[model samples]
Target: MKKACKIYDEKTIGKFVDNELSSEKSKTISEHIETCPICDSITAKYNHLSNIFVQSTSKQLDKIDTDLLGQNVLEQIKREENNFFKKVFDYFSPKLYLKIASIVAIMIISLTYFQERLIRPLDIIGPSAIVNSVDGNVSSVMIFETKKSKHTIIWFSEA
Candidate 1:
């Protein structure tokens, strides 16, 4: 076992081994660690621990069943996709369909009622009034017809 460092702590030495310190600080620590045996041994220990961690994690990853993991992930994705469509279909329930159908039926009935009762024909089938005689002292006569009630206007203009 190496003695504890006086200037830099074990954490600082770990940072140096990981190259996480600033360039200037790293240079200073590197110089100090080269001279101090205690820091050097601690840095070696940190490096050994880091290497062991990398090797063990790599071995664990190599031992994993990647094909099984991929199959499970794909199955979950398929289930999620199916659930999305199921939710959309569930939103249009029987009651919602009945409401939609009722609204359409009401609209059709309202339009039929409006066409029959509210809208009037602009043209009349026959003459609205009979012109029996035009015997007058007028030079010109003008006749006008109203649209909705089919009323007639006889205007006599004298020269």
Candidate 2:
């Protein structure tokens, strides 16, 4: 006759019952149970207890009242809708848009006025004066040279 194997602790037996042990550990436990009658009895007891707990808990949950939960959710949605328009009006008021538009318009007008009054006049005045002076000087020199020279020969010299 084979000798009986030693019984494992409740924790190790629970892990084995729940299929949480590694393959090597499970094989060792199986080998021990094959030779030991006490470990086989403990494993059977754990299996019976787990089945009873699962069945009883599932039956208890099926008896709970779910009608009140649905009613409470509908009440909350109704209360939110009653205040929806007021919240939207507060967020998108006409006065806010008017204020923002006025600020943008003032900025655009000020920028346009500054560009026209300051930058444009300076640009026109500075370049026009320079070109006019240069043209006047060149015209005056040409008139002087023509009036002073009767048969003048201009020679090019390299400096």
The number of the candidate with the highest TM-score is 1
Residue range 1-159, candidate 1, lDDT tens digits: 746878999989888888999999999999998899999899888889889999999999999878788889999878876897776766775797879978999988887788655444433444478666676788999887677667777888886
Candidate 1 Cα outliers beyond 4 Å, as residue runs: 83-159
> Over 4 Å off in model 2, which ranges?
1-7, 74-159
Q: Quantify all predictions' global Cα lDDT against the true fold.
A: 0.82, 0.69
Error of 1 at 151 (Å): 63
Write one digit per residue (lDDT tens) for candidate 2, span 67-136: 7988999998788667879667656568977789789999888878798676665555322322222232
In TM-score terms, candidate 2 sits at 0.39
- Best by lDDT, which number? 1
> What lDDT would candidate 1 get against the real structure?
0.82
Model 2 lDDT-worst window of ten: 137-146
